[model samples]
Target: MEINIFEIAKSSPSGSAAVTFMSYTMMENLLKPDFFNTSNDTIKTMMSTVISATLPKTNYTKLTKPVNFTLKHIREFDHSGSLSCVYWNISEWIVDGCAVLETNSSYTVCSCVHLSTFALIMQTRGPQKSDPPLELLNLVCVIVGLVFFTLALLTFALCQWSPGVNNVARINICISLLLAHLLLLLTQKFLNLIRPQQVLCAVISGLLHFLFLSGFVWMFIEAVLLFICVKNLSQISSKKREVLSSGFLCVIGYVVALVVVCVSVGLVPEGYGSEHCWIKIDQGFIWSFLGPVCVILAVSSEYKHFHMGC
Candidate 1:
């Protein structure tokens, strides 16, 4: 650390007064309750201890000339983390008079106009420790579900049921749900690579929203059809058929989801991606996806009383 006396020395020179340097490694616990603004990321000090350098005789708050400080990194450096030159300011740590000059994996050089207790802080986007078992479980479950979904879709396509039975809703349900689950698993597995690319993350999140919603819509349609079939089995064998046409059912299956996603995008353009590759929770943006899901579920649960006129 370089401490140069500029105008302060010219006005009231410290002369031969010695500058004292002290490391408060043991006293770090006392200063642990800090008010550093690090958003949501986990924070850690680069060095194991805090250092204090002060001019014993002549004390100054602001210096006329900028000084430089080199803080060595004690822990392993992370490429995805951010580093800052911060100092104790009363009850908190801030970088008001300090700026990062040069940085490397080993150490960082900080240029500041004034000095106090100084240290280097690092912030990383991920948690300190992750549960490997939970992650493995999720991966295994999603893969198995995807395999079953694919098999169901293939069966629907190849197997021919009785002409009296309609499989339009079931087919669409399998197709949309399979695609949605696959996309979700892929996005999560590659989240680290995709999150940095803002535009790509946003697009993927929007696609996921549409696919999942479409799946829900198809499921609700199929549930309503099942209810009708269970209640009116004798009329199901009509030659001309009693239900809506396949084309109309197909359109309704996806159109509702598309419309909701379009409106959500129009209302909050920046709410597509966030901490995860999904709708951000900020500004009630998550409600857009949740609202439709809740509506579909509520309606489906009460489908027994609803008349389909089929």
Candidate 2:
């Protein structure tokens, strides 16, 4: 019937002091050793459900272990001014529902909330079930895509014997696309776990948008390069057709993507995603990506048709 409360004082700068206390209460219906020793599964299950709801939900999330309740009555002031028991290691005291009252009574009633092993178990609920086939399919697809793209990039980079304008364009395209897909996959899988950090989420969103846009930009660059190479096939050795190089083409592709991403972010920084950490699809912000893509696709198609017609 006796509840023990432990009070600890915490001091802050600027002349401020606060006290945190932990209270442990015993329930005869739940904490009795004989009650848990029953061989009846139905009775134990019912008691667990009852105990889970017995704790006040307005303050505490889960119930602590039973040993936290034993306390001795003391009426004195020690040098440390702390009346805590060594058995009170079951939970760490929090300030959620802690208070101290001045009274002339033999014992004080205190309510406190703390995090413990039971709280973690309650928060986790139970083991989650997932479809094994679906999980395996998703894993296989990601692994295959990653491997193929990696090999494709290595091949494009290592093919030094037949290096040409087209090969250079393909290499840049592969690098950009590879980075974009890798970043997108990583962010999608991991960014959701750290939603509490706003700045980090924003940075992740910006990077994903930039990388994806860079991928698309490189694709567009490849298209243009293809068109130019085809158009100048007959004048392959002409100095006039040698204006663009691999490095110059890379600069154009990356710079264009960077400028678009930077301008979009600067104009409406909030346009970056909120929940999923991606570009916001609303408020014309997405047009920055779609507009350029549409223009490039149109130009490439037009040039292709014209070259074919000639």
Candidate 3:
């Protein structure tokens, strides 16, 4: 029932510490001369010793002190005799001579090693729940955006209804935003699944970036067209030029965005964990999309009011 304690050392700059401890029964088992110098026959004798020590008459209850150890210095330990040794933080500590009685019935010692290591790594490196919740909300936004977009596109294409040039441009802006939301949805979904394939992750990320950039470019075009219609009514007649220019700009923007995303994030697929496959929107990615749209909206708003004044 009693436990013994021994201190090894302080761990590192991290200030963690290591210690060793053993139960009385385990210490007695280790004291046996043949405990370490064991063949198959010797092991059978040790097993018998352990079984005899664990009998009801022995009544060994627990250890006197809990072993404390840092994870940094754990090396291999001997688990071979009446006493099982656990090595942690470069120190070996013994448990009970009959500790097999306390061991989980399902897991062998070897299997426990692999499973415990896997669980520890996952706990340290896995995604936070906070962002995933926001991603789920974004997904819902994308679905709603798609529905509105489809309705708007259908109205524009199929219905004879013609809103004014400005209104039509606004509709285009809505459609572009909708497409952006859809791309966002798809990117978030793929990230959630945690697929392990590198090539597939890169392709999906590239497509999402391309689509997102195109959506913003289209929005800018809509704004510019609206501005021209309001402030420079004469220039509105050059709709053919406007359409051609917008098409060229959209293509160029998407190509550039795709190239950059592929080069940066796509090239290194393994650095970040499975949760993140795409280029994060930290360095000018937001500006690349939002900046142009903001400018277009500002110009369009000013032009619309100016025409109203006239």
Off by over 4 Å in 3: 1-89, 92-124, 130-139, 160-180, 190-194, 235-274, 281-310
Candidate 2: misplaced stretches above 4 Å? 1-139, 161-165, 234-237, 240-242
Best by TM-score: 1
Candidate 2 — which pairs collide? none
Q: CA shift at 265, candidate 1, in angstroms?
A: 0.6
TM-score against truth, every candidate: 0.60, 0.53, 0.43
Pairs with backbone N, CA or C atoms under 3 Å apart (clashes), candidate 1: none
What Cα-based lDDT does every candidate model obtain? 0.77, 0.51, 0.42
* lDDT tens per residue, model 2, 153-199: 89877767544456666676677667767766676567547545766
Where is model 1 more than 4 Å wrong at Cα? 1-128, 233-243, 306-310
lDDT of 3 at 3: 16
Which lDDT value does model 2 have at 136? 71
Residues 51-164 of candidate 3: C-alpha lDDT, one tens digit per residue:
111112222223333322222112221121132323221122223222222322122121111000010000012334567677678767778778988888777656654444
